[model samples]
Target: MLGNLIRYLDSVVARDPAPRSRWEVLLYPGVWALFWHRIAHRLFNARLFFLARAVNHLSRFLTAIDIHPGATIGKNFFIDHGFTVIGETAHIGDNVTIYQCVTLGGSNPTNGVGGKRHPTLEDNVIVGSGAQIIGPVTVGKRARIGASAVVTEDVPEGATMIGVKARSTLVKAETYAKEFMPYGTPCKEPCEPVGSQRVDELEEQVAVLREQVAALVEANEQLARKAEKPGKPACKGV
Candidate 1:
């Protein structure tokens, strides 16, 4: 219990330090997620609705975690940084690691009021940051939801969801891990560079565009300030 409290404090502190080392923050989020979840579950089961809501709101405010009071999360559920959110009816299985900005929500017309308006995630699943798993679908055990994906349908066991609308990029776990994910990268898929030169060229172009945009913005601001200033008295020819 004391350990959980310490972890929770660590997680809360992690968010405030943007410049802190990534490795330091990485460990706390997972630990704190499970800790808060235990408290939230207890409050929910005890029918302490107000207390549960308050705790939920406070956790989200402090950790960028937006878990609903009614969400049923299993043991060892790890919610990583980057803004993690779970809907009211989302059912999470054991040992699931969900990264930031991943929304496990439902789109049913009867949602927000009640009636099973969220997805069920099976055990050992890992959802990357910015992934959206919507509706009453089920993600099978050990499945992986890639970054920025939009999943609306059921995902089979040990499958991987990627791309818009979230198709099964790979169904087999071993192959999927080898192809999509990398080692020690915190649920990130190995980016398949189009080509070394191509990537470098695109990066260079982006840098140039950013510079131009910055210059234009600065110039515009200067012009606005000058326009707001009282008209300079007719400049002396001298």
Candidate 2:
């Protein structure tokens, strides 16, 4: 507890010194939070849940970080900046990287009590800054969530999700695909050219229409000739 307190103090000092230096950010609040979180998590895992919760709340008050003791995090986890709000039910996998302003919580509109209410991120997932992954969904291994994306559903393994509500632009189809798949290969099979085939059929129909038009034009000319010079009438057109 004393060690965590000292580290928390160091983090505060680092954030607001006489002259703020970017180098000082190496030991920022989130960095210290990660260190203290491990301790708090261990305490929770050891059945000292009350003490762990107390320490977690105290740390949040001191550091502006809100990592829950119930959240399982891995080693060397660097919280790039502060104000990260990790939820109690969030299950973070090993070697997962997170950035500042990331929110891993539930989107339960009911606000009702009980049940799993946080996301589960698999190993080696890299979440971009200000990303909000909500609900009890699972983000599969090595998936990359783009900055400021709103993820609500399960992301397949090694997928890269982007845009609102997080659509997968690139899917890591196989475990070996990440290391071996060639560039320019389509994520799914290439779609056949239905448009070109329709255009060809339309062209044939247009040619038939043109021929009909030409025949009608000739027949109309014959009729005009007959009308201008009826059976024994004047040869001079009217």
* lDDT by residue for model 2 (156-198), tens: 8888888897898865635433431112232222123444666
RMSD of each: 17.4, 16.4
lDDT of 2: 0.74
Those runs of model 2 whose alpha carbons end farther than 4 Å from true positions after fitting are 1-26, 109-113, 171-238
**Model 1 TM:** 0.62
TM-score of each: 0.62, 0.58
Off by over 4 Å in 1: 1-27, 110-113, 176-238
Give the Cα lDDT of each candidate.
Answer: 0.73, 0.74
Write candidate 1's Cα lDDT for 1-238 as tens digits.
Answer: 7675545444433323332433454456555555566688689889998888888777776676778878888755666564777888889987677777888877867434558778999987888889999988899987888899999999999887899988887566756454322233322212344345569999999999999999999999999999998875687774
Residue-level lDDT for 53 in candidate 1: 83
Judge candidate 2 at residue 234 and give its lDDT: 66
Q: How good is model 2 by TM-score? A: 0.58
Error of 1 at 158 (Å): 1.2
